[model samples]
Target: MSDWLHNLPVPMMALVIFGFTYFLAALVFVAVALAATEERAKSLKAISPGMLPVLGIIFGLFVAFTAAQVWGDSDRAGAAVSREASALRSAVLLAAGLPAEQETKLRGLVRDYVGQAVAEEWPMMAHQEASLKATPPALADALKLVVTMMPQGRAQETSQREIVAALEQALDARRQRIIVSLASVNSVKWWCLYLQALCELLVIGFVHCDNRLGSAIAMGLFATGVATSVLLIAAHDRPFTGQISISPEPLRQIMPEAPTGHS
Candidate 1:
């Protein structure tokens, strides 16, 4: 069910589901209002003057909530990319302290990792892969060797410990980047919020139907509002998929060449 929902084309899905829901709600509202009018036509000859203001307040609150969620998700996705890039850059600089051959090998692995993340992992994340195959076994081996090659003395050991710490930090950052990328998809809350928006639109339509604002004005407002919300949600959910996504330029710029000696 989740996969089916995610695979839906954005505009069509929003229109079909939200539109149908709003239609049902509007029908119900109209039916109830008609029944009330017939039952008390003589005694209660007036529509509630407070209905518009009440609906407006409710709609405003709903819009604000949706906006806040979208904004929060957008910021998180952007921060994740920045944090991952900073960690990768620091790891690359730290690799310079290793022996020349080790340095070369480690840098190569880092470069490959970045490239694979940009080119391959971004796509796989949409399918909900926890992490990418960026750090191969060879890279892990090189990291282990860096730990083993520390000189035997308190001062040198301390420096080695710092290097190890940095390496660990880098690995953690990489994992976090992958996790955030995969997890940024809209949560169940998003669906519920969308449903609420549709309900609000239906209520709006029923309340204003007597004003005779014409179908175009009514639909235009509802469609525009709903589409904007969905687009914002989808963009944040798959930050790396669309044109507005966080670019891989930072990683690409720092990509190192493959080292010699590895077959």
Candidate 2:
């Protein structure tokens, strides 16, 4: 229920969040107004000094902090995807420097790896699941296969070394990306965000106990703003699941197609 709210399109998210929060705020206001009437016989104060402004400041800072953290996580996830693709491209270039037999074999492995990652593994990540179990990169086997072909001379040996290094880097990048796909913000932080939002509304409830309709309007506006920010943060909570997600464009660009015979 909450996730659906978070990932909704911006206008829908704002409307839904405002609707729910406004209802709750109105309910709180009614209760507070009754209490204020009862207490007025003894004391005529609506609320304590400076509570609303203080709570507003606190809410704003919390939103800013959470947004920054989630933004950083999303950026890191995207960079991991790019790095993995770059390493794979490097491996392909170095593989070309090998003998014809080794070159074909290595290129085939690279091609299969790219194709699988783009078509199969990427969809799983979008769903916040681990990558597909079938057709695992078999990266180790590929490395060992290349190592089996002893280089003909110093130049070949150097090229093989660079290819091995690049593949290893690609493997590391893929590992990072998989870990990132499974990542999420902590539950405690979410609790704090919601708690503060409620607190801000509660402050409004108490301060506006004398005017229900005016309070409701104020809360509607406030709720619209807060809920939009909260949903924006929530939309970014899962780096791979929302509007601002990492794409597999890099991998797709390198996917091997059939050989052409134009000549």
Candidate 3:
């Protein structure tokens, strides 16, 4: 069920979340209607006049802040991906300065690394897992192979050094990408959101029982609005999954031979 939910497109997920939230709110309304006495409802309604606006404002701000944080994290994850791809391109260009024989070897190594990255590493990003084939030792082996040959000239030597540095930079960026991919909003925060939403809905259900149609309409809208925020956060939460995932296009273009991978 979770996988099915996660696989849904952003809009679909938003709709699903909205429907579920509204249904839950409806249940709350029914429960309150069953449980409330006239006297209790009147008292709660009296307090509701003073409380609803304040609670709405606080919860709205909290949800907005949480959404902002997730969006920021997703943005950083995308930037890290671009930076990693750029460094890879730099390493490729630097390889051009080597002798023909050495250049072939270095380029092949780079190609394999890139191939494995797109082929094996990229798919793992959706789940925030590192690809074993694209691990440091595997990439380092490819790099070590490039530096093993003596440089043909001063220019070649300089280029080799640059290639090494660029590869290192790429690795650093890759690490950052991995870290960002793995990061997510805390579960505790999500639980708190649910708790707050439930409380607010319960209050609304109790205070508005006299006008079922009006309360249902308002409850549906409010629940959908809050769920939309949550859905937006969920969509961006991974930055490497769902409809808004970071594309592997940059890596594909940079990779020589351009191996088709599971995107």
Ranking by lDDT: 3, 2, 1
User: What Cα-based lDDT does every candidate model obtain?
Assistant: 0.59, 0.76, 0.76
lDDT of 3 at 171: 84
Tell me the lDDT of model 3 at 163: 86
Q: What global local distance difference test value does model 3 have?
A: 0.76
Worst 10 residues of 1 by lDDT: 36-45
Per-residue error for 39 in candidate 3, Å, reads 3.0
By lDDT, the better pick of 1 and 2 is 2
Q: List the residue pairs that clash in candidate 3.
A: none
Candidate 1 regions with alpha-carbon error over 4 angstroms: 1-49, 132-139, 152-159, 184-191, 214-216, 259-263
Off by over 4 Å in 2: 1-16, 38-44, 131-135, 260-263
Estimate, for each residue in 149-240, the C-alpha lDDT of model 1 and write its tens digit: 85556645554566566566656655665655565534666666556665555555554544434433564566566566555555445544
The alpha-carbon RMSD values of the candidates against the true structure, listed in the order shown, are 5.0, 2.9, 4.1
Tens-digit lDDT track for model 2 on 178-227?
87887777788778877898888877766666667877877777777787
Candidate 3 residue lDDT tens string, 64-127: 8788888887888888878878988887787778777666666667777777767767677776
Candidate 2, overall lDDT?
0.76
Which 10 residues in a row give candidate 2 its minimum summed lDDT?
38-47
Model 1 TM-score (2 dp): 0.69
